[model samples]
Target: MASLSVPINPLPPPVNRRPDVKPEISLTAKERDEEKRRQKVNRKIASQKATSMKLRSEATKAVIGDKSGPSNSKEPLPLLENLRAHIAALRWESALNVFDQLHEQLWYRPDSDIYIKLIVVLGKCKQPEKAHSLFQAMISEGCGVNRESYTALLSAYSRNGLFDKAFSLLEEMKNSLDCKPDVHTYSILIKSCVQVSAFDKVDSLLSVMASQGIKPNTVTYSTLIDAYGKTRKFAKMEATLGEMLREGQCEHDVWTMNSTLRAFGSSGQIETMEKYYDKFQCAGIQPTIETFNILLDSYGKAGSYEKLCAVMEYMQKYYFSWTLVTYNIVLEAFGRAGNLKQMELLFRSMRSDRIKPNCVTLCSLVRAYGKARKAEKILGVLHFIENANVMLDIVFFNCLVDAYGKVGCFVEMKGVLEMMERKGCKPDGITYRTMIKAYKKGGMNSHAKELKGSFASVQKSSPGLERQNLQHSVSRFDSNPAS
Candidate 1:
């Protein structure tokens, strides 16, 4: 028994058990290199995708019609696309650089499509002179100009108030290109003539269009009506409408009817406007936003706020949303009528509807506040103007200063002047005149004298100003210190 126990004890010396350990993993050199390569490839793919997206965005901005780059350049289409995009995006200098990169054959090669697109882009960028030059270059290159091209050029000139050039181009189209005036051409010319009050020229153009067998479309009638309305020639507008009706050519188009209604509304002929509305319905025509706007503006101008509200209600019922111009019209009417409460309510309604108040709206509010003698409210309006970044023209600033000065807030007036100066706006004659009047009223004789002297100095520096009248004003100020 003792021997057996001794043997068993000797057999079991030590049997130590420990927790299992995981083996460390390590990549081979080749594996590590391959992994790095994969990462680089992924990065390159991402970079390429980003670049493609950028190019697409740029190309969209350029409004490129075709995918093919200029035929001569072997470079990537993206490069040319980017250039065109820059031009469309209004990066004129960058666009020029792109054009420089294009093949010489593409440069100044009159692509009517390209020319028309560029003309529209440049006009939007307010580079009308450059746009005109491009048009001339197109013609010089013997590129056949299309009606669309001529129309774009004419529109650019008209928009920039270059009516002389616009008319010259029209004549060139008729004489050199033998391009008969289309309905759109006549409409553009008629609208331009209306704007410049060239009624006789508008009539002559219409006559020419008729001779060319170009029927006076609805737009033609609308243009003539707008022109007559602008000149307050109600009789002419009515007579024109009558002629259209008698000729059996009176299609009761919304635009045509609106134009007539607008003319009547603008002239404050409420009865005539109503008559047109009845006639429009009788002719089975639906009134558009323009029609409602015309009626609203007319009612507003005539100080018939009740009628204005009724029209606004009609607009809502008809699902016609109000535009900024609509609000502006109503606000201006209320301001003129000295209805401050109504103005405030309208402003609140506009804000509630998320309609951004423009400079005109703020100006109208300020005017209403001034009429009500609510100095605090006027200051609030000024604050809104500044906060909203609505540009305050000289007239607006002058009005504010006058309003504040009238309320004996000389400090506020000076503050506004300082703000204008800080914004890089120089005080004009109107500004100085307003300041002088304020100082004189405030009995700050020395300040008024200083302002008068400064005005005189400016006039002296710029001899074109009529300084004699200002000198007389200064003498009056000197003689009457209390004034």
Candidate 2:
């Protein structure tokens, strides 16, 4: 201590020492608190803006009604826009109401698109008169009508069995409107003529189309072929196909080939159908499902299991994916051939392939099982139908009831009837007749009498009930004249 003091020469007055000084921050507590509050407010404002932008985007999309891409254009005026939306949604009456409002409020400008849309809607709604009136109004307004407008009207009339109206429209399209009858227009008119079995008109239409330089497309050829086939005029069908080939304008497409095959099949001309099947491929046209279905159906109807199997094998080899109709055709073939084992195997295979059997398939199987007197198997099919939620139509229900009744399983038949009623499906005359037949076979005369009465009542209530009742009654009377 004494040595240190000797080196310090009169130490300066004790320097005032202070603790380490911290940097002086600029913000005060009040300013920091204010800054935090401002930040929170800015975040809230940004969030609100983002939400508003999202809402606007959704609203814009709703207005534009496009499947893809952004809708930039503002929606059309409210009345017209609403009317269009209603039409798009198929709310025909509502759309008509809007149209009426539009006519009253806005100036009545004959917009071709609107008129077309209205006509289509009315036609779909089965308001043919309204559709016709709209068409007349459009013409009166001097609106330019296109092919679609005339075609739509013609189709409506055709569907309703108004052949005269359909023909008149066709003539007007050609004569008054000066719209050349294209293949489509001609096809519609031809189809209508065929529906009415007006073979003469179909021939005339085809000739007219040919003379006008309007080369018939695949549809035209298929329609004419179908018409000729319906009337069992195979010679005409052949001549038509020959003409198509000779014209150099039309080729033998799959549809034309299929139509010819169907005609042959329907006429039980299995040999001819097979010949054409070979020729179809030789003509450099690929066979389609329609071709296979026609051949298979023909073979099935003829109970030719060998031919059906051959066709199915060919289908598999060609990698043609089997459809419900394909399976149904084979099922029917096996059924009619009394090849129950093969039919069952095919039905099981259908399920294994994840192909759900439709009403047609089930009906075929039920009919087959009934014919084989396999009541249990038919019940199993009914359960499958239920499990798959497959809706049973009149034909399906009739088949099931008949199958159960054939085996004298009154309980199961009644169960099916009750289930059908629960599902709001009214049994047709065939169903009642089948039930009566089963009751009679089982010697349950009381039930048979009741069912017969019900059948008569149903027929009386609904006129023109497809004549299934009359056919069934005749068969019953033929079998048991005493009844």
Candidate 3:
């Protein structure tokens, strides 16, 4: 009965609220105020973060050469695609320009992988400073700093022969908590050292790797073997191969086989090269087109025409397609053998096969024609070059000069410098040396002396030119040596 008598409004009327209820209402208001305050604080924090990121990006852009604001026209994907295309084309400056454009896009996000790719491209283009700049920009953009990023930057420096910077960076990587050096890091450094023929440094790096319990991989052994073979360090090369074979984890690949073949083939050790080729075959490493090219090149250089022809026949028998390098190699071989008629036929055949001739191909024609004293043929090559979209480098220009000089085309020989200037290729010490030697051969002592004075000035300014010229004189005396 008492429960049924409970009032509908037991507490209070509208103006007679209890004190406890007043406290409850106050608590709800406090919670509302706290939520609003919390929201305001969050907004302030987000604003500060956005401003900091914007400022950091601005600073990074200032360092990276583009100060423009975000572009609204191009979408992010297209911009990124363009950047990748330029990089793949080996156009370093163009790639950087596209990267700048990408940075100016509103939807752009910093990507460590893209930065690493750009850095690698710059390294290949011999633009270590630019690569370093991009690496710094990657860090400033708040991109994740990891082993890959450090290795890429290290590779850039190493590729450019900046060993000091490379070593310092390696030390830095060692000190990094998140980016300790790995086998790939040591392998890359070893390859760089091998490239410069700095065997001492390579040994030091290997010892360091061993001390750190990092074993050599296939790439590392291959690099060492290739370098040693190229440098005629047979003992070291064989030792490296032996060590690689002993490592159960490092199975021999096609590259390894090619390196071995190339080492012996390039050194004119045909017997040894053939032996290794057979061994590799027995080891189940199938030969690639590069393998055939290496064998052909070696045999061609050593005047083993029969062997070269044998390799060619084998390739044809196997239905293997001829690459541009294959065409260049055979052309050079025939050219060197004074078989111009066959060389011309092959050249025509190469074009019919839609393999456009490159600088190396043109160089081969010029050198062969020059040796045979066919000035007209050299002229024909020049005409072909004018029509073709082949990219000419300093080596090609040197060959052109030699060809002209060989055929007593003094005027044309001198004109190559103008061609070089137009092509935006600076003449190296080899270029000057070739020209000077040609002038002296032509009995133009006065001109030779003048060029000699200029060369002296160049050497004085560069300090390294004389050494480079000496090496060129001793080792790379031919206009169109094997590629």
Candidate 4:
């Protein structure tokens, strides 16, 4: 179309020109390389930190063992075992340390159940302050609080005989609806008060519970009856039991009967024990294994071997499975009756029944053998235990020493002491007293003096343990047992 003067001017670069532009201040090659190195260093440091934290988290969780997790899970086995072992051994110090480690974990979250358990363990170990610290930690961690946890901490304080602190905590719980004191709480407090013979405090606590409209349950009444019976306050014991039978929230159970019988049995009131036993039986409360053991113990201690034999016959006729405790009671009864043959026979039967003998059973055997002038049998028992890989506790060693001493085997008795040292078992006060008595009887003044010196050293080394030893003297098994 013709001769149009088409002046298409040369195109200018696009307006943005991003591809052509360079930064105002560009990095030199050296600067760029330095920046790359810095980034690499930072990444390496961060990776190391991440690994460190991961290891710490694993270690912390390992201590706790995540007991709430499935029991069959294998990953937390060792930690779970550690927890159980420490708690079973009543190693409160180790347990608290483990608890602290658990809290320091990276993935750790507060848990009420864990705190409740720890608090209870601390109460058992009589470490009230540590328990209170755990409660404080639970609060600071923003965990849910409940009456059970409060009751646990209260128990700790009560066990330690910090009555004021316990009451203060109880009052504190009263003010907090979420952590209000229940029958268990008052029961624990009442038990503690009764333990220390603080009857006034007990009365006041009962009054407070009534005012608070918290009714006493079976446990509360059982604890009261047991405590009162222990103190020989038969009137109070009978009254509490009567109240429980009449108007208490819970019915009388085997435990109350046991407590009643124990009180009478411990005081050599076998007739009263039997009467109460019959009454309880008529109340539709079935006898437990513990019941039979208690009866056997009372009869044995009262020198009513005929009654003990009758009870054994009844148990056999009823096909009641003999527990480790039952075997121990029978062995002790036979031992006290000076029927060494029967005791040894029962010992064999105990093993055949697959019920492993504990220290109490072994002690009964030792005392029996000692009485029969068959001290050699004790050596046999030691050998048997070694062959069976049964753990040798200090009590067993003490029993060994006592048996040898009673037989006038001073050399063997001292050898037991040496064995104890080699086995890392510490000789307690009972051990020292036993050896000293034997030494004096043997007219070995120098040996007795030497033992006295060592005994003093042990006392110095473990001052707190002396009180615990005294408490354990009244062991769950009869204190004046066969051994």
For all candidates in order, the CA lDDT equals: 0.75, 0.78, 0.87, 0.82
lDDT of 1 at 351: 86
By TM-score, is 2 or 4 better?
2
- Tens-digit lDDT track for model 3 on 251-363? 98999998888888877899999988998899899998889999899999999999889999999999999989899999999999999998999899899999998877888
Model 2 residue 152 lDDT score? 79
Query: What's the TM for model 1?
Result: 0.67
Which portions of model 1 miss their true places by more than 4 Å? 1-110, 119-142, 145-178, 247-252, 383-389, 438-449, 462-483
| Quality of model 4 by C-alpha lDDT | 0.82
Give the TM-scores of the predictions, in the order they appear: 0.67, 0.71, 0.67, 0.70
**Between candidates 1 and 2, which one is better according to lDDT?**
2
lDDT comparing candidate 1 with the true structure: 0.75
Supply the TM-score for candidate 4: 0.70
Q: Give the top-scoring candidate (TM-score).
A: 2
List all candidate RMSDs to the true structure: 14.9, 14.5, 19.0, 20.0
| Leading candidate by lDDT | 3
Give the 10-residue window scoring lowest on summed lDDT in candidate 2.
474-483
What ranges in model 4 sit over 4 Å off? 1-149, 175-180, 443-483
Model 2 vs. true fold: TM:
0.71
